[model samples]
Target: MSRFAEVLGRLAATIEARKGADASTSYTAQLLAEPARAAKKLGEEAVETVIAAAQGDKAGVASESADLIYHWLVALAACGVSLDEVAAKLEAREGTSGLAEKAARKT
Candidate 1:
């Protein structure tokens, strides 16, 4: 596996393991326990990442992107969605024009 995949796999595994943990001790558990809260956090992180990128703060962008990914994974986990499900969606988009894909969504 690529390093990126390995890292994400490990992070996803850790989040899964934390699902049954005490929320007071594990932030991941807290996020997993509250899907709405996890979704809100994901939104917040996404905005931060966008702001960092807009400001041309490379380091800030990287840091905020990591936060964004973590919160996104947590939100997906909380909603009982798996990485494979997300991957399938991406795979389906392969070779499709972005504009065409988006236009199809509107129908």
Candidate 2:
């Protein structure tokens, strides 16, 4: 795997470990304590990312996108969803048209 992928995997593992940690000390634990809060944070980050992209701020978009992915990973961890599960779903969609995928989901 690439170094970036390895780092992301390690970060996900660390976040998962922090899920049960003391909320007073761990930000991940604090997020895990409240699902709605985590979801809200993810949404906010996503909006920031979009705004950065729209404003043509490459650096801002990268920074906000990082925040967005972190929150998304946190939300997934908080909900007991593993990255492997997500990867499997993506793998299953390989070679499929994006429109077809959306149509299949609606069925």
Clashes of each: 0, 0
**Under the 3 Å rule for N, CA and C atoms, how many clashes does model 1 have?**
0
Q: Record all residue pairs in model 2 with backbone atoms less than 3 Å apart, i.e. clashing.
A: none
Per-residue alpha-carbon lDDT of candidate 1 for residues 1-107, written as tens digits (9 for 90 to 100): 89989999999998988988999999999999999999999999999999999999999999999999999999999999999999999999999999999999999
The TM-score between candidate 2 and the true structure equals: 0.94
lDDT of 2: 0.92
Off by over 4 Å in 2: none
TM-score of each: 0.97, 0.94
**Residue pairs with clashing backbones, model 1:** none
Relative to the true structure, candidate 2 has a C-alpha RMSD (angstroms) of 1.0
Query: Top model by lDDT, which number?
Result: 1
